[model samples]
Target: MASIDMDAFAADWIAAWNSHDLNRIIAHYGSDIVFLSPIAEKLMGNGKVAGLDRLRRYWTAGLASQTDLKFELLHVLRGHECLTILYRNHKQQIVAETLEFDGDGKIQRAFACYQLEQG
Candidate 1:
């Protein structure tokens, strides 16, 4: 695993994501990396992604589809070689997620719990 600098890695991840740069985002992950999205039942492999082709579909269909897809970093906790970030999605609705990053600074697991807020 690449000994990635935590703070820099987190910043880059958020920047790439917010920019909607699929290529840059995918570059941060390993070829064998796994993703556990809230919408998925089981862990999904990079191969299962069908490559970036599938990512574009979700990026446009799921994320871009939202009216105001904004995210704010609530907190970040670091361990020996792991990092967890609490973030809130501010759009038409408010959603929160805590992402766990592996030693390589790639997201290994993500837990997303949602709630509706009256604003």
Candidate 2:
């Protein structure tokens, strides 16, 4: 993961979400991906989504619901075997999307955390 170029990754990631293309967006993930988010909990009866098939379904539903979906990259944090993307989504919500990479540099686990809504 340390060998990965974050500039390229971030650009491609932002592009993938902005394009609203499922295949492109999912390309960076591994087959055994595990995704977690508060939104997932609301939509899937839990915060965890395991496996590629389930991830596809979860993201598809999200995309369908948020027709104006888009994300703006704000920051990128790289770590050992992990990286985090900080961005603002279509709803103007800030998200810290932390991803753990498999040995092959594919994302195997992810957690999306939101900034508390302003009062």
Candidate 3:
């Protein structure tokens, strides 16, 4: 999509998270980003984390206690103007993040879904 290399994008995304650098992680996003995540719902009182400022805050808080946070990429699914990264977190939770890119190739929107815990 938009001539963006999905493999490189996914690798950089995973690396950004693993680096635990807020600015590095946010660099992939556009200023008008809208991100949806279960973690966002828990942190921001809603599933929508609209805009860059709010997103930065939410992610910062989410990572506060996750010093060992890391992501292991499992799959990168490409689509029109979008891509989904399936990975396992340091906690061993399976997560899927679908990201839609803007004309500039910066992520304009994103959605994060987690696999339900097995009993």
Candidate of highest TM-score: 3
Tens digit of lDDT per residue, candidate 3, span 46-115?
Answer: 9998999999998898889788999999999988999999999998999999999999999999999999
Candidate 1: residue 80 Cα off by (Å): 3.7
TM-scores vs. true structure, each candidate: 0.61, 0.95, 0.96
lDDT of 2 by residue, 1-119 (tens): 66789868888988999999999999999999999899999999999999999999999998998889999999999888888999998889899999899989899999999998999
- Candidate maximizing lDDT: 3
Relative to the unseen true structure, what is the C-alpha lDDT of residue 30 in candidate 2, on a scale of 0 to 100? 98
Q: After superposition, how far is residue 84 of candidate 2 from its true place, in Å?
A: 0.7
lDDT by candidate, in order shown: 0.55, 0.91, 0.94
**Of 2 and 3, the candidate ranking higher by lDDT:** 3
Q: Name the lDDT of candidate 2.
A: 0.91
Per-residue alpha-carbon lDDT of model 1 for 15-117, expressed as tens digits?
7767766677677654444444544333333323333455445555655455555666666667654565556665533444444556555655444555556
Off by over 4 Å in 1: 41-57, 92-119
Q: Provide the global lDDT of candidate 1 against the true structure.
A: 0.55
Evaluate model 2: give its TM-score: 0.95
For each predicted model, how many residue pairs clash, with residues at least 3 apart or on different chains?
0, 0, 0
Stretches > 4 Å off in candidate 2: none
RMSD of 3: 0.8
RMSD of 2: 1.0
